[model samples]
Target: MSVFTAVTEDDLARWLGDYAVGRLVSFEGIAAGVQNSNFFVTTTLGRYVLTLFETVARADLPYYLHLTAHLAHHGLPVPAPVADRNNEYLGTLSGRPAALVRRLSGRWLTDPTPAHCTRVGAMLAGLHLAGQSYGRRQPHPRGAQWRAEVAERVLPHVGAEDAELLRTELAWQAQQDFDALPQGVIHADLFRDNVLWDGELIGGVIDFYFAGTDTLLFDLAVTVNDWCTMADGSLDAARSAALLEAYGDERAYTEHERRLWPAALRAAALRFWLSRIEDLHLPRSGEMVQVKDPNEYRRILVARIDGEARLPDRP
Candidate 1:
């Protein structure tokens, strides 16, 4: 129930006239995401998801929409934007930039198997390969520079132990040679919920808002941290192995990426931990919102720091 903007039936019906999506049969606010105002829109033609960008700048939106369209065109399972008569993928509704995309089938798997991880790994590599010629360049918004800035902002609110840990981790990450690793467009946030599954196959990889240019290993780190973790925040060795092996089959990991894998995992955990803490103390308002527990990533970060979870050796 994270719909921040309300769209009345009359307003939506009028909006539908611009696109050839047929008459509006029904529409309701989607409750899953925390960023945009999403609705499950049904029309006489097909089912689609309409999203109203809330925090995203109107000018910066073309990168996301066009990236999605490009990925879909390159045979990846992504939500392609539904264009209006003018061949424009973006429009305005409820005083916010909006766009419609075909709704994908299947549900997110809460309890994922190694097979599922394998599928995600392969598809992620495919996504990176597909974006080799994407043209547009958007740096990772939550990269090291932003993380350092936000750490100072959130330090005053956290406990002394947490603050010290944050400083140490950030300083260590800053010293790493991430430039040597392979670089490409990455889904910076590839949490389980963002991926849709039809049985063991990935129906689609949704939520491209956080995507940007970064080391390929960082992207893999983000995926493994969430998708390959057990309940106790420990990395599941089998699942991690499956993911890395499958990913390597598509795009072989460079020796540099392999060497920096551990640091990348640490960086991924720290990124989420800092962002979650900020979200908890400095909150944002939305029509319907749910704040995730910062402690979850804190536990994952601590585990990574303790050298308890290591990715399986490159196959």
Candidate 2:
């Protein structure tokens, strides 16, 4: 996470007064991501991740914080947001809307095996299942509308070939009836880096800022695109099967979902490609900011259009 808002030790020590998590022991900025300002906060009681919202508005904060709490309450391995003395999960620190959640154990896997993919698939299905009862309803921040807008915004910054691809894909996706598919709250950005693993088990899932109401199949497609893809942007069959099979065990996919799997994969790839291009061309100024290559997802979008991936059969 980028450090958009820098907080001094003195600043954090004072902010800790409103919480019951004891005195602040130490705090450091997280530098891996480019979205929010994140810090590894250590207090006398335990470890927590403090996030200062950068793009997310203060009013829309409750939907994310409460969503995590809701998932944690349902026995998922999500980090529970810590409520302050005032019984609120959100707080203001350093003039930015912020939140703190108990940091769970383990690290995100960089090179995940099929077994790992299986666990992620199962957990994702469980997440969608648990989200059925969530009280809040927010449209996915990077859903269809955002895709069209962002693709248009970034087209002028790219070459002619990429611009044509964007236009073609945008038109194709517009004709899709994703709203007709099974819908619910989805973890729209369930990439490999977001899931922490403790040995054979998934320790925790983080970064719920992108979670919202969307097609459950689209969510699965997003995960598959990240966790099951290869260096050349091709899908690895073993990992794909492991993940989709495990997911189907929990909530079986309908025939309609199966029929639309290829299009959904293209939709997922296009969204991330648009986002990466936007980040690369129209980036925000922040401490330790990282902008990933837009070309990686660009290759994936092309590969998906070539029809290289499909829902794998269960063993």
Candidate 3:
């Protein structure tokens, strides 16, 4: 959910009614993101997440809508879009195109253990397997892609050492074999906040705004980077194992995938590190949001690259 914009109840209810599957009962704002406004909406029929698009590319939304629907159809844990009576999935609400999705049940896990890591890994793998059947790919955006957003936004705001380390990492990444990784659809942003948990089980995965067709293993690497890397730059063995085993359960890896895994993990770490730094320096329009420190992940990435960290053994 994007929290950068202001959304009022009456403003949403009026627009929401046009596309709601049932009579609108109540709408409450959920302040938790930097790109879109979200509301926990209730109706005579069920609960749903009402989103007001604030700064998405607009034309690219169908990918998220269709992808979630596809995942739901394949029996993955994702909230499907609640269609209007006319079968319209996307509708104009408050002058912006919006959609209501079934609110997934679960909470953002505050304490993620190794077992949770494994479950998350498995869920991602299942999603990746399901995504292979999707037949569309959005054209790569022109100008700055997210990978470069760090240097463009954050480096200028901090100490020179941070900037220098980030720039060096970016240059090093530019020389890596990005295309050599396994290929398929990827959920580029599946952080802890995105995965909902019910006790030890992952109830659902939310926030598909960054879902796209990319390297399948790269997605796994991304998950491992987010869910397995610790604050002190060490890869937690049990957590890493859990995640890898979870992913392996859905999509078995090839020799090529195995060979590229380590580098991909390093690459994924750097990707988020840069994005965090970018957000720190370039504050988007939002009421003060807490931005994570990029240096932590930068240290994590360096440790992974230097063989100072080890991902758990996978068969």
Candidate 4:
């Protein structure tokens, strides 16, 4: 999350009174992502992550926060939302919905190896399995409908060739069917930045705001698009193979899922491309908002369509 909304130390201290998280020793605005306002909060007792929801509806917060708790209860490395003295996981701070999660150890990787991909894949598989019982049903926000809407909003601002590509890709995505594929809760944004690493092991996974009910394969595709892609946005065979095989070892891939892997990869790429384009064309004012390059995912979409992205042969 980004620093769209400013949370002054005094503002945070007043909010801290609602929780038993100890006195706020210090806090600072986090300046990385684009969805919400985030800060690193340190207290005498412990450290925590403070988040202020920007665009998410208030009622919808529980589905995401509770799903994180559910995964945590299942022994996943997700950060569980910390409840206040009233045992509430959500509150209002600086006129926005706010939350606290115990700060987790480890740092995110900039350049992950095949071994790292293997660990991420296994953890993702475990997440899918554990998510089966969450029993909540929030639709994936970046589905086909959202793609079309975002594409419509962004098309006029792009070049003719790029616009044509977006149109054709959206049509291709609409024709696909995932009814036969395994479906469950998915971390719709499991990019490298969302995961924390301690040595060779995964120590933490954050940013569950994008988690939702969707094809599990789509989740895997999203991870692969970010974690296993080269500078030109083509998949690295060794890294992708390590990840796919590791995931398959934990949870077998269905024949249908296997057949649709390439399409899933393309779909995942398009999702990010559309969002990035929107962010670039229709940016909002914020303190630490990162407006990413839409072309990054555009290259990925092209690579997937060119067959550079392939799921490993199922064992």
lDDT of each candidate versus the true structure: 0.88, 0.91, 0.74, 0.91
What candidate 3 gets wrong by more than 4 Å, as runs, is 139-145, 287-290, 308-315
Q: How do the residues 1-315 of candidate 2 rate in per-residue lDDT, one tens digit apiece? A: 889899999988998889999999999999988789999999999899999999998999999999999999999999899998999999999899989999998899878899999999999999999999999999899899899888878989999999999999889988878878999999999999999988889999999899899999999999999999999998888899999999999988887788789999999999888888998999999878989888898888898888655665542
User: C-alpha displacement of 112 in model 1, angstroms?
Assistant: 0.5
Q: Per-residue lDDT tens digits of candidate 1, residues 112-172? A: 8898989998999899999998999999877888889999999999999999999999989
RMSD values for the candidates in order, in angstroms, are: 1.4, 1.2, 2.5, 1.0
Candidate 2 runs further than 4 Å off: 313-315
Candidate 4 least-lDDT 10 residues: 306-315
lDDT of model 2, residue 257: 87
Q: What is the lDDT of candidate 2?
A: 0.91
1 against 4, candidate with superior lDDT: 4
**Model 1's TM-score against the true structure:** 0.96
Count of clashing residue pairs in every prediction: 1, 1, 5, 0
TM-scores, each model vs. reference: 0.96, 0.98, 0.90, 0.98
